[model samples]
Target chain A: MLDVIKSVLAAFFGVQSEANRQRDFQAASPWMFIVVGIALAAVFVLIVAGVAWLAAQ
Target chain B: MKRFALTGICFLLLAALMAGSTYAASINTSTGWNMPPGVTDVSREVYSLHMTIFWICVAISVVVFGAMFWSLFAYRKSKGAKSAHFHENTTVEVIWTAIPLVILIVMAVPATATLKKMYDTSNAEIDILVTGYQWRWRYEYLGEDVSFFSNMSTPRDQIQGLEEKGDNYLVEVDEPMVVPLGKKVRILLTANDVIHAWWVPDLAVKKDAIPGFINESWFLVNEPGIYRGQCAELCGRDHGFMPIEVKAVPQEEYDAWLASRRDAAVAEAAGADREWTMDELMERGAGVYNTYCAACHQPEGQGLPPVFPALAGVGMSVDPEQRAEHIAMVAYGKTGTAMPAFGDTLSPAEVASVITYERNAWGNDTGDMVQPSEIRDLLGK
Candidate 1:
C-alpha cells in the first residue's frame, strides 16, 4: 500500500523511477492507478478554484 | 584541431554577417518584448501580473534546466560515471509536487483578483455603443446626439504604389472616436454583421463585437492622446482596413468638440441636397469608393473576377444604357449578393458622387456628372 502511494506520488511529479513503476505494475491493480490519477487531477482543479475563491473574497 | 579552427573562423564570419543584417532590419524593441504598462491603474496591475508570471516561469525553467544540464555534463559516460540503483525518493517527489501547486496558487490568486477588477464595469461615467460593420466602425454616444461612421481614409494611389504612403497609412481613419480623459468609458460592443473584436493594446482592453450579442468592456485613459487599434478578429475581406482610433481629451474640451461635431453633422445633412459639379462629384466619389466600394471592387476597379466583377472598364455602371440598373444596385443593393445596399448607409449626395466617380474615373471616361437630387429621385425620397 505504501509502495502504491509512493508510485502515484512519483507519477504526479512526472519523475517516476523505472524500478518503482515496474514494481507498482506487478503488485498493484491497474484500476487502482487509474483511480488515483483521476483523483489527483480533480484535486488540482479544486485547488485552483478554491484559491481563486479565496482571492476573490 | 587546425580544421576545427578554420571552421570556427568561418562560423564567426557568418555570425557577423547575420548580425549586420539584423542591425539593418529596424525592429522597434523600445519597451522590451512585453505588453506596455498603460496609463491606467488596472493596466498597471495587469502588467505586474504578466511580469510576475513571466519571472516565475523563467525561475522554474532556470532551476529545472540547470539541474538537467549540470547532471548531463558532470556525470557523462565519457568521464567514466556509473549509474545509481536508486528507485525513488519520497522527500524529493513531495517537494517537487508541493512547490508547483503552491506556485500555481500564488499566480492564480492575483490573476483572479485582477480579472474581477477588469470585469466590474459598473459605475462608468460615459456609455458608448460601438457597432462593427463589414469594414467600418459606428460609434453612438448614449444620451447624446453624437454618432458617426468611422471609415478608412487611405487613398487608393498610396495603397497601389502610385503615391507615397503616409506615416499613419491604413492605421488612420476619417473620424476618431473621442472620449473624456480620466473617466471610465463603458463601451458596449456589438456587430451589425459578422463577429469582430475591438482592441486597444495600450488600454489592454479587447472584447468581441459579436452579432446579436452585446459584449461590454471599459477603459479609463489618464493621458490625453490618440490611441489606435484594429479589428483584431477576422470579420471578412476588408477586415484589415477597419482600424480604430480613440482620442482622449479633457472633459471641457471634449464637450466643445462634441458641440462642434453635432453642428458640423447638421450642416452636412442640410448640404446633402445641394448640386455637385463634375470636379466635386469626382473627388467625393473617389473617397466614397475607396472607403466603401474599393474592398470588393478593386481601387482601380479591376476587381477580383469570378466573384467580384471589375468596375473600371466593365460592369453595368460603365455603360450609359444600364445606368438605371447601376443606380438601383447602389441604392437598393443586389439580392442574394455580397453587394450591400447603400441607400440607408450613405447620404444621397454620397451615392451620387460614388456613381459619378465610378463612371468617369479608372479610364471609363463616361464623364457623367450626377446630382444628389437625381439619386434622391431614384430612391423616391
Candidate 2:
C-alpha cells in the first residue's frame, strides 16, 4: 500500500522512473493506484482552493 | 578544455544578447508592450499578476533554454563527446516536474486572489445596467432612472476618407457612461440581440453580454479620466464601429451630470407630445438615421441587400399607402430578421423623424411627415 502511494505520488508529479513504472505494471491489479490517484487529485484541488481562499482574505 | 572554453564564450555572448534585449524591453515596458497598470485597485493587482507571470516565464525560458544550448554546444559530436545512454532519469525528471509545479502554484495564488477581488461586486455605490445592442451600448443607471445610448461619434465622412480623421477617430463616442471616481461601480451586462463583450482595458473589466443572461463586472476608478475601449466581441456588421467611452468624474460632478440627464430625458419625453414641422423632422431624422440606421440601411438608403434590404425606392418608404406598415416595421422589427425593434431603444420623436427622413431623402420622396404624437399613440405609450 505504501509503495502504491509512492508510485501514485510520482505519477501525480509526472516524473515516475522506468523501474517504478515497471514495478507498478507488474502488480496483479491497478485498483490501488486508481483509488490513490483519485484521492490525491481531490486533495490537490482542496489544497489549491484553500490557498486561494486564504490569499483572497 | 579548448572546446569547453569556446562553448563558455558562446554562452557568455548569448547571455549578453539576452541582457541587451531585456534592457530594451524594460525601457519599453508600459509604452505599448506591457499591460497598463490601470486606474483601479483590482486592475493594478491584475497588472502586477500579469507582470509576475511574465517574469516567471522569462526566468523559466532562460534556465531551460540556457541548459539546452549549453549541452548542445559543449557536448557536440565533433568534439569527440559520446552520447550517454539514459532512459527515464529519475532525479532530473523529478527536479524538473517539482520546480514547475511550485511555479504554477505560486502563479495560481495571486491569480486566484485577483479573480476573487474582481468577482466581489458586493457593496457597490452605483449599479449600472450595461446592455449591448447590435453595434452600440446602452447604459442604464439602476434605481436612478437615467439611461442613454452611447454611439460612436466619429463621422462617416472620416470613415469614407472624405474628411481628415480626428485623433480619437473610431474610439470616440457620442455619450460616455459617467461614474464617480473612488466609488465602487458594478455593471450588470446583457445583450439585446447576439453576444457582445464589454471590455475596457484600463479598468481591467471584460465581461460578456449574452442575450437573455446577465454578466457582471465592476470597477472603482482612483482618478478622474476618460477611458476608451471597443466591443471585444464581434456582434454584427458594424462591430468595428461600436466603441465604449467611460468618464470618471468627481462625486459632485457625477451627481450633477445624472440630474441633467434626468432633466433631458424628461424634456425628450415631453417633446413627443407636441407638433413638429417637416423640416424639423427631416433634420432630426437625418441625424438619427446616420447614427442608428446608416450602418445597415446605409447613409443614402442603399442597403447591402440579401441581408439588409435597401430602403431607397419602390419599397415601404416610397409607397404612401405602406406608411403605417413602415412605421410598424421600425417600431417593432420584422421577426427572424436583423432588424431590431426600436420601440424600446428609440424615442417616439426619433422614430418619427427617422421614418420621415427615409421617405424624403435618397429620391424615395413620398412627401410625408410622420408626427411623434402619432407614433406615441401607435406604441400605446
List interface RMSDs for the candidates, in order.
3.2, 1.6
Model 1 misplaced regions, further than 4 Å: A1-57, B1-32, B85-91, B154-165, B335-337, B363-370, B374-381
lDDT minimum window of 10 residues, candidate 1 chain B:
B24-33
lDDT tens per residue, model 2, B68-109? 877887798998999888766788877877887898888987
| Candidate 1 per-residue lDDT over residues B94-169, each given as its tens digit | 6877899899989987898889988889999999999998899999999988888999877768877999999788
Clashing pairs in 1: none
> What CAPRI class is candidate 2?
medium
DockQ, prediction 2: 0.72
Return the top candidate by TM-score. Answer: 2
Q: Chain A alone, TM-score for each of the models? A: 0.71, 0.90
If scored against the real structure, what TM-score would every candidate get?
Answer: 0.78, 0.93
lDDT of each: 0.83, 0.89
- Identify the leading candidate in terms of lDDT: 2
